[model samples]
Target chain A: MSENTTYREAVKRAIHKAMKEDERVFLMGEDVGRYGGSYAVSMGFLEEFGSERIIDTPLCESGFTGAGIGAAVNGMRPIVEIMTINFSFLALDQIINSASKLLYMSGGQFNVPIVIRMATGGGNQLGAQHSHSLEGWYAHVPGLKVLTPATVQDAYDMVGLALDHPDPILIFENSNLYNTKGELDTNATPLPIGKAKIHREGKDLTLLTYGVNLLKALKAHERLAKEGIDVEVIDLRSLRPLDDEAIMASVKKTHRVMIVDEGWKSGSISAEIMARINEQAFYELDAPMVRVCSAEVPFPYAEHLERAAMPQVDEIVAMAHKVMEES
Target chain B: MSEFIMPSLGADMESAVLMEWKIKEGDKVKKGDIIAEVETSKGVIEIEIFEDGIVEKLLVEPETECKVGTPLAIIHSVSERINISPAAKKRAKELGVDLEKLASQTKGTINLSQVEATDEKTETKAPTTDGMRQAIARAMSKSNTEIPHYYLSTSINMTAALKWLEELNSQRPIGERILPAALLIHAIVLALKKVPQLNGFWQNDTQEIISEINPGIAIALRKGGLITPAILNTQEMNLNETMHSLDDLITRTRTGKLKGGEMTQQTITITNLGDLGIESVFGVIYPPQVAIVGIGNIMDVPWAENDMLCARKVVKVTLAGDHRATDGRIGAQFLDKLDKILQKPEELL
Candidate 1:
């Protein structure tokens, strides 16, 4: 059942499966149809599902994003593909005001079943404008299901599950993970939204992370294991509705937590996790909560500067050392 | 000056009576030396010093029932003192604050607000333990109400096992005699391996099988309540390791020196009433965990072998399991496997 595939190919298979299963489902974006995709996410969708299902729109994020909301309110499941998360800012009014509030503002008479997918995060020298990790910003807004699938199996399963969600869903895919190859289980089951997966079992400290940083934490955990410092690495598949039970259970065992996030440190998702840990498991902690987030800067252009700006495996290992040894 | 306070002997002990002081003022002592004997709810424990110093003053008198953190003596070392705020000193006097806690907070000066903040924690030590008892009560009551538990009992021949254990003990010293409880625990865990359904928690609408066979021994405290701390990974250990771990667990359980995570990750529980000479026991299931096993006193009984009557040593084993997690048939299979393992006692080692 294991099919070795790239992260981009897994996503394309999920989209391909979902569109074939339902006629109401379609993909709409700037370059998703004939131009293949900005990152080839919907590369062959126009040739297979036809141009009607593979909608190629103008270079306007807000316009197409609003159209997704309109189609969703009228009982069509349209998956909006924003080329990059940096450009999602241009569609803020559509995402926040219309898609998010349609069901509640209309007294539950209307519901938006729109799944918005975007290429997010740093690496690959995407520079400042194209490389951004703002999934945390969308997580702050209510009525939006924010999912960040970190594994190949999850990339194949998460999108199809999001299509059935009644409200809007925002799927954040890391740009760095597109070429990362992994074994995708053909019989992969859909993971429930808001639940986290423990990538490695350990007893020293929990490294909570999502998306691209999940790999970094796993790498650090492996090296830490060799040094006799057992660390638990958790990939938070869902960004919002933080799984407090999983977080607290790990913290209660380890009594320490180090969050690795690609987002900037200030007011990032890591801050939210720290606050939750404090509220729930403050006395259980043997040491202070620590985090290794991207350095507060616009995504850098140079290779060295970009690597320095974002979270690295070495930083995660160092943070784990601080949490375990500083006590 | 280093202050020695009344130590909380166990998680349940809020206070203890200072029975005797082994050292007097002007006497020098080293770390790890027994300095005093305090009578806790469990029993009298000889407390040890963690630092080297000269006894400067004996603040507490004998036969005084002091709450935990009440200063007993002051030991002066070669080091000097840091200036404590006057308000902090007054607050410490009023609250009888434990200065060791403050030392960890700041190595420099102690302040008034720190004492005020720490006072609430010390004041509610009793309630915190009561909170733990209440937590246990909640889980037990939840198990009782929600779970439909079925009890099963079986009598297994123990003649081969008792003879094997007696022969094995002949070679060991008097101080290292392996008790029958260790063999019972070994049999229980091996049987659990064959029937793993009884070793996991039924929670979150899922039946998760706990891989590690951690069996909690229910040790009744001398004070009043019972604390069940587990012997971790008994399946990975031999009969000697199991005997040593069980002995260590009991001593630490009574003295309140149990290791970290010892009481938390109990996959299953074992209650042995053989020591009390009880015929059989039916223990309530500790919630989260689905099963509780009981071992009774081994006695000589008349048995039929190949259509002939004969005398054989047998013991009653009872299992109370959550019907939601497992059935009566599974319980029978587990007991059947246990009976088979008892016949081959060498496998336990």
Candidate 2:
């Protein structure tokens, strides 16, 4: 049985299922209890699980994130939520140095089985202070698993899988994707952490993306199909430990690649993926690898500027045309 | 210093025995200078250097057969030890400044003032066109002196071929139309494919049949001399592609833009003297190649078809083959195949 639900409800149900199954599981973050999550993801959770299980902390990201990591180390499974990725910088040291390195530093005696979820990306007219996407930064850190769930099914499955992981895991939810609706199987099995999914099969070119940009890429694929330009769309569900096998296989078949990234172009994840493709599958490419990344400037407050700053479907379609036209 | 490796002269040329060196160590060489002679399956070819340099070391001894890409010598660039500003470099090129002489006179960076002083002091050289004629004289004399040649001629009826080509060209624009020369080259390629023995080199007391057919087209330059640069891999081209390549090759050859591989990679040569109103020609086979096909003027000649004497457009075709590699029978077979192909010119398309 499958249920049609938004990404927010799918995540809320995954967390509720975890809390019901595991006594060690508890939710902790600012306004997670009384506020029912800053995005209303935990509505009615406090009333059902009570104050002890659905606990909310003061406005301090580093303090509560550190407490959650410490609790996980002491045999408690805690899901820590940050209101936005822009504020996650306040807990960068705790997440990178403490939570990520604790198991290796303790000689595998203590494991930081903590899960941190942060709302990321811009498109909601949120100013630069609230709308930065820092998932690429977290992915650069070793010893930490990074997951970006774009679809509702992945949102539900990835959360359930991240809680079962022994090491620290971070799930970056694109802020604009919470309202996007898709089908979620009631008994959906958890997807493997580092495997990518091919949403469409094509022979002309491969379009790689994740998070909210995946939707735009799909729309661009539809537009390109009308013009006889067949495109393959792949969602890189995991940022760290990228699926090189899947990426190379698509490159071998299509012979062209266009990466769509919401992050800035310079030193971004898209650059890293291009470097990897050049290193491993250089001869398979017929045309140079192209990327459509966000503008280097910070997120603009105006809706028009924000839309222009981010990579859009039209830009993706135009870039696909340019790539196809090349050898 | 950069190593000068043995280049693959043709598609089938894998290795070459170093026969002689035209330059020794400490010799200053300019680009396009014949620095060495290497003997491959196609006979001794004069190898040209592509950079202005001084010979630093000789790596391969004469008579040593080395594989392609084996370093034969090391050449140290003349300008490597000297620093010249961008403006000075441009001025030197315009003045044809002798960098070696300028380097001997100065130290540190060579600037525009030094270039101007050198240009004023040195005598400017006059342009000469006799060098190409002299090179052709040496190569043709070598071919006449070394190889025993045998010649044969046949008359091919071009009435059908010309009519077919005229109809085909009528449908296309002027620039995209095919010419009779392209059809002739295509027919020769097809004939070579049928009688493969004549489409190769006469080397080392035997005939070496090359896998790919590269026919050198003898195109006369506008000035006084002529060059025969091979249309590489003619076997793969159709009539239209053959026409395009022939046009491109002629333009580049006249402009002195032919590449080194085109100069040394001919399996056979084709010389057409028809445009000059010559009734017949017995061409000298370019050395190392076994045969040369010559096309003469197409004229209205008396023909007896089905015992009826009538006028027909016919062309005089001649083949000169190396007596050592092939015989009169092979040349006759090739000419026959070529005549049959021209009878159905649409097959070339």
Candidate 3:
């Protein structure tokens, strides 16, 4: 069965289903109980699951995140929400050093089965403080798995997959995608984590993207198709433990790549993907890899400046054309 | 007993200042040992002793300027000599092996095998020469500006020559065997006799077909530069004689023992880059000379003979002829004659 839903509603339905099925699963974060959620994802969940399951916390990121890790290690599956990715820096020590390492540090005696979710990306004009996509930083950590859900189906699926994983996992939900509506197939086969999905296939160039940029790349591909420049669109659903087989297959077919990422250009996820392509499929490439990424600057407060800093649909189209012209 | 004179270090050098004596009177010195330093226009160069001797007298004083052949020192030859077999000595001369350098490397009497090993070890390219680097740069720049060269090439099937060489080497001793380069040089001289149009110079606004066939052989120095010294009067020699002269020329070129006339008397040049694994080489004419012949790597290639396809060893030969000295027809005829000569390898001997 399929139903029309926004990314926020699909995510809320997935969390509600996990709460109904597992008794050990609980939700905890600041203002998660009485105020519903910062984005109203869990409205009225405090009354339905009661205060025991929908627990609230004080305004301390590190303390609450560490407590969630401790509870996860003991035998409970806790879903910890860190409001925005920019504020997650306050709990960096617990996320990378503590939660990410506890399984191996304890000699495999204890596993921190916790899922940390945060709103990422910079299209909402939340100013420099609240709008930052720092998922690539967490992807750099070895022991952690990172997932960026771009579609409503993935938003419903990846959250349940992360909760079932034995180690720590971080889900970056782009704030701009919260209200974007799409059809969600509830009975579709679940996709395994760390596998990329191809939205459209072509012979000219491979367009690799994730998060909100996936939609922008799809739009760019439609425009390029009209101009007779066929482009293959691939959504890298998971960042860490990247699907190298999928990437190499597309690269060998098209012999050209254009990575569109919302993160900044330097040391960003696009750089990592480009490096992997060079290492594994360098001889298959006909031209150098191209990328359209966010400008290396703090997110601006003004709407026009913010739009200019992030990658747009027109830029992705232009970069794809550039790759075709080079080949 | 011999007098060590001021050696001509380069074609352009005529005089240098005696900088300092590293050894005094009565000091015993072996071969390849540096005994003095001279200040040339290039830089301070350390001069090595060519013989094992005891210094009898220092003829030139420090800071005194001297011409190219002026006596710099006098030494008495040592009786305790490094012995080498007569066969090995003959082989070394033909191979142009530096016996003094070979003597410094071994303790016992040297044999033919040891001399061959030394020749094989010195084939690789090494570091650089500061002055030779600048000289090459200036000459190449001049050649690029003045010479309008026309290049032509052809592939020679070497099935007959290689088979003949293998059969000939099987019957002879190791010391008497001739290399493929020697055979190629012999054929080139014979071909030049037929097409005298290429064996000459472009001077005084006309082509000068010199009677003497002094073909310059481009030898790359171990210290990272190149020098082309001619094997004078190849038209008067046979295959074995040409091979011996080539070896002696190479040895003297490396040891700084070249005569002044060999540097400026080249009528035509030949560069064999086959040992470096190059597939084809089109060399630039080293000015004054009208043409340069280049030989590339020989490898097995497919051939069609009498409507049958088979593999035959083949090599690519190229000629870079100055447009003013010769036309394409003459260059093509020369290559055709060279191919015919190589086919009858027995006639070359």
Candidate 4:
């Protein structure tokens, strides 16, 4: 219980715990069983559950994803691992067209208890193909629950919550954060999907973000704190069915908002958040909403190019300072 | 004959550039006519004639910077004879005594020495970099110094109002969709129509309120700063028309392309914070206007009805008024009427 573990280990332990506690739960995806998952988040699970339970699927994302959906509909809890969000596009037919729609399109006949885990966001120079933060894209799709666990506690608990959800769930883990380690309270209960956590409370401005950007926002928050700017960092762990109540509550106290997202600028989650703030908290705003998003370009192979393409700590800090000055 | 003293033009400035003249010596003038354009730190502002008469003498020429309170021109009435003061005549002579030549060359009193002095000062002083910032500072300073403000806050249930908006939006195109801000603006305009007393200027000297419903909607610009652009004659406009006007004003404001009449002549203001999630905010009453309405965020809260608690969408509205012009009773009555109008949003339409 007191052993040092990586973020990847924390997630694997949570999955193992949930699967062991419930016999209905099983794992399925390419390399998830025999290969112990592409990121090793399911290492040693195949021996414990066997090939039937720990399903090693073909490279067909749509096919295997469809299988996961079918299994979930038939009263089996299925966790589908997509190697990376970059590969999820192949499975969009099953995820978006099938999994996301089953609950609503069926008029509530079928509840798709499917958890689709994907490593998202560009950081390790995975080139344009492998690296992408597609959480916003998934969040935009209705009937799909999107969860991004930035901390160990969240990573340990979100899997349980996603399993409990009677709908399709997309959980994004940053490839760069796999080695990040933090303490986890084993007895911690599962968190509600739509609730945002204020990791650091400050009065100057509210930094609203989720996923990998949450870490970037926290870094920016630390830098700003040194400069005497009290930035309130809100980690929107769940993207869809957004916790506007939590966001607005913080906004009411802070009076300024700066959204941080790793997605491209236009039509991103930041735009939606800004619009909601404008529609809901217009009077409380002393300044207009600011967003720090990834550069609207394809990810490049060069380390410097990729770093520039993604939203950085400096950019977030600058945005926070700008909002602070406005307030 | 009466001499027109140079207007202060603005605070902080002791002198203003006499940029141009609309009239010359011997020209007949009427009160309220644009007599000249004076350049200050703010902008080139038109100076209006105060009295109806014939221009017998002009004391300040184009390009001349004259001190405030210095005589700029002499307007002679039909019953009064023009008398040139000996001191002014001597001063004019010492500065090169060619009255006819000066009038012919400049069409006004050519204060050459004053112009030379101002030119020397301009070269020595650093030019102001931010004109809008300077104007805002001056305006804010003046308002804070001159106005006596009092704030009153009330919570309004927007449950019925939002539902009405949803119903209205369902029937409209995406472009014509009714938003909460639009509905609030409409409600505020209608409320002003009912409480016309709040929509006016307070003449502090006489302690009288002059009513006009020119509603200023505070627009937050994308680049920086807040500006309250006025929507003239709010009382006469329908909900759709007001919404359309507000949309146009905000579009212009965000683009930094506001027309001349958009910022000035506001009789009252509405600062909406509903989008930013603030429950209620107390706003400082902009000077001249007796009151300003601050709209807060809409949220679900428990409300008591028949001794039972029920969830309802409530918005906090604060009305900041000049106590000299309005009493608490009048403010309370206005808010009550505003709440009623907002609750029954269909009445505004």
Candidate 5:
């Protein structure tokens, strides 16, 4: 079935399919059952999958998320959904202390096959607490596999892939992408989580990034190509075990890099990428590495300020020009 | 299925000696599995396959020399059939022709150009060999015979450098001791910036200046001959970083655990004969790369300063460059910069 759906809908379909395929698979989150999910991702999931599989919890993110992990440790595949990334901070103790470290701390005996999904990024003028991108923070933890499903296709397939992996995986979904529609081939296969995908191929500069920033980078790449500045855009679908091989290979050919992330610049995922490039392919670069990141400030309340606070296509293009220049 | 050809380890290496086989005929092998060990002019290298297959036949015996691009076994792979010409493969790719489409029309070898010409088919054969040493032999011979090489040597005052190294190492633990070669490498990297023309490759009748200064460091193996694997991006590294990297590189090179890029990514070379007690050496430029910087053992030499002759520790530096890419003037500038760098070896740290 050739289908076109929003990113959030694709996510719902994946959860439904996973639950149908396996008896032990279940989803638990705030408003996921009777309330049909905060974002309406699981609108009818409660009726079809029933309360046993589609669980609705109170406002305690820590309590429900911990229950999901405990269930996962006991051989049940639990998909924990956080209403928003801001609330994931409330359960940071459970996610960091137990979910991520269980396998290593337990001598590889307890492989936490838990998938945590959360709405991330800023666009809806939600207050600072609700409108922040914190996927970069999760990527720092060693035992967790962090993912960003930018496209509808990725949103559709990555959930299943993450569920199949014998490790804890945190998928950060951009709140802005929930309404973005794209074609999803019904027969599409799951891509390996650790590998990156090249959205565009060029030879002059490589735009390394993930999540919804991929679209802005692609647009910038196309604009750059018009001026004969071929820009290669790589979507780093995997965050924790960053695909350095793909990043380095692109940098080797391009001789320049521009990392665009929704996170803050200092100590951000972009910083990690620049450090990796410095360690692996510092000599391959002809110019200094550049980062197009969200401004290091609390999410602004005003729309204009919000637009100015985040990474845009023009900023990426300008940064590309700056780094790709001959000194 | 998949033909495990002799890998081109280095730009200069064309073949290797099939010293031993870890897996014989009928043994199943997986990707990244060490199937054989081959000794090149550099050293014995453990060869790993990139595909899973069953060893159908052992094409060449152990200890036999072979050439570059020579295959070593007829492995019945879980993958598709081999022997598809690259040109035909490209054509097939352009037309979206896959293995399934060709399997019905052809048998054995599949060549797009010859498909309609005849029903003639080519047999699958793996031409295995001990070609690494031979490859190096052929490359170096070609470089010596065809390329116009110009050599330049200079005596550098290493008094301050040696003194600096001794003082720096005295404060650190013995395991963290820095070698003199690190200083030399640092100085050469800085010199390369000033004299950039000689620090790259001469390819396809053109001269290209490489941005990063990855120095191919010659490491002597236990058996004989030597392999010059690259220590990448030396320009950005500090003297301390250089020292640590050199330690790791030398250790890995001797252990035959060299990364693939290390073997093939030399933009220029650094040959230090100081450890072997050589006073000076006029070394060869590793092919593809255009230049090499050589350092000799430091010795006490008489120096004249302020009209007084005093004994100073001095080391000889030699530059071997491809004359086609650069002239003696460029080589002289590099040596001059090197000498100046050595005077302030403290800055390298």
Candidate 6:
């Protein structure tokens, strides 16, 4: 029952556990039935559920994603996998326009209880087209809960929470964090979305970020700690309906903020976060808002180029220190 | 006759191009009349005539760039005027002090150092560690030396005020910033209008009181230390004008570019430590000003109204005045008027 698990393995275990608890739960995706999965996160699910449940389909993301929405509306909980978020663009019409809007647009007549999981973020040398962190983009759309689980406990707990919700949910898993191991307990329950968790408590500045950037913020926190700067790392697991009160409370204490996001600088989630802080806690601010986001360029093919395109730990630390020294 | 030195309009200004002259060489002009237009860091501002007299000579012409503190013109009074020595005029010109206005106001020969001291006080210096520490030293020394300041603390319910601000701000643009500071300024102006004695200065030399409501607002700069820039005739100005004036003062103060006229002649002062979460503070009265008001942070506290306890957002306003000119009853009445005005902000509009 107990075993050493990576974030990816923890997610796979949560999916299998949910499937065993309810016969109505099923898995469907391209190559998920026979090829296990692109990352092997759903390796043995095909043998367990068979063809009737472990459904496979052609390379039509919009079709399968729409099918998943339809099945969820009919009282069957469906787990849909779109190999990577880059391919989710082809199915964006189904996920954003259809699945995300069905509940609100129908005035509560219909509910889309589907969990769409996708591989996100860069670090696997997965070239320009294959690697990108689109969590901020998905988070921009309303009526869909977006979750980014960076730890093993969150990976285990988020699946049950998504299944229990009466609306469509999107979960982003970082490709480079697949083998990162952490502790998890069986007694862990579903966590409510729209609430931020303070993973590390420090007094200097609050680092607001989510998804793969959460790990980068944590790394920056460690480096700042060595310089005698205690940084408060806030894992904003949920993006929309943000926990603004929590963010403001932390900002009032620290008097400074640095937002991190793996998205373009303009009109990104980091911008929205900083705007909220400015509106609510401007008098408390000692310095203006600082943002560390992905460079405003298309991801390149080379390894060094890709790393430069994404937000790094050094940038976050430098921005935090700069703000601290200003006031 | 006294020499009129060119006013240093703004910080970082070494010289100015005399744009246009509103008065001719022999034109008789009164104080506060626009004599010329000069451009500064902010915008084109009309240079005012600081004394009443006939313009004797025009030292600088239009299109001519003159250094600050140089004599721009000369004026002669028809009636008996205070005698000003040529050495004093030279010294005043060097210090950028308007000798004619100083002689007219003092009704005696004016010391150049007093003008220099006044100018020194007006110039914005980046607050160094020693300056702030010295200010603290002077403040504590004065508190212990001069007037005995008795502290009286009480909180007023601000639930109504907070709701009013929210409703007013919803209809305003982002530029017309409405903050607690604006509300406090409005309330204090109304109170001082009712009790003009609180706005008077404690003149030690003649043992006389001069009443004027030149309300000064304390601005804490980004770097350190503090500066009080006064808004003349606060009671006469409307709320919009008050807000505009305050915005102009704060913007200039933060950028370290406050003009000479912006700093001189304050009759009363208001310092807000509310932003820093100070519950209440007793500010030392800046000499000549009889009263100084301190505003505290707004917080929710349980209050008993109609024999029932309910949470209300409340702020404490403390008034420290010169007992030589004002008593406890006058101070209490002023506070009551301020509280009433804050509760009914529409009257100020």
Instruction: List, residue by residue over B199-293, the lDDT tens digit for candidate 2.
Output: 99988888899989999999986645678899999889888889999999999887778899998999999999999999888999888999999
In model 1, the runs with Cα more than 4 Å from the true position are B1-349
TM-score of each: 0.53, 0.52, 0.50, 0.52, 0.49, 0.52
Native-to-model Cα distance after best TM-score fit, residue B187 in candidate 5, in Å:
59
Clashing pairs in 2: none
Which lDDT tens digits does candidate 3 get at residues A1-327? 999999999999989999999998999998889999887788889999999999898888999999999999999999999888988999999999999999899999999999998889888878988889889888999889999999999999988999999999999999889998998987888799999999999988899999999999999999999999989999999999799999999987787799998888899889999999989987566666899988888999899999999999999888887766654
Question: Can you give the lDDT of residue A221 in candidate 6?
Answer: 94
Deviation from native of the Cα of residue B287 in model 4, angstroms: 27
What is the C-alpha lDDT profile of model 1 across A133-246, one tens digit per residue?
Answer: 989999999999899988888888888889988989999999889888899985767778889999999988888999988888888988999999999999989988789999
Model 1, B169-216: lDDT tens digits are: 998998788888998898898999999999989897778899999998
Candidates 2 and 6, the one with greater lDDT: 2
* Best candidate, TM-score: 1
Instruction: Kindly list the interface RMSD, in angstroms, of each predicted candidate in the order they appear.
Output: 10.7, 18.1, 27.2, 24.9, 17.0, 21.4
TM-score (C-alpha) between model 1 and the true structure: 0.53
Ranking by TM-score: 1, 2, 4, 6, 3, 5
Chain A TM-score per candidate?
A: 0.98, 0.99, 0.98, 0.97, 0.97, 0.96
What's the TM for chain B in candidate 3? Answer: 0.63
Docking outcome class, model 4: incorrect
Candidate 6: tens digits of C-alpha lDDT, residues A54-119: 888789999999999999999999999888999999999998899989888899999999999988
lDDT of 2 by residue, A169-208 (tens): 9999997888999999969676799999999999989999
Count: clashes, candidate 1 = 0
Residue-level lDDT of model 5, residues B1-349, one tens digit each, is 6577888889999888888999988788899999999999999899898888778788889999978778888777756554554334544555555644455334455544443222122111111112446667888898898678999999999999999999999999999888888878878888898888988999887999999889999887655557888889887898888888888999987666789999899999888888888998898777778888888998888998799999999999999999999999999999999999999977877
Candidate 3 residue spans exceeding 4 A from truth: B1-349
DockQ, all candidates in order: 0.01, 0.01, 0.00, 0.00, 0.01, 0.01
For residue A258, what is the lDDT in candidate 3?
A: 93
Model 5 alpha-carbon miss at residue A226, Å: 1.8
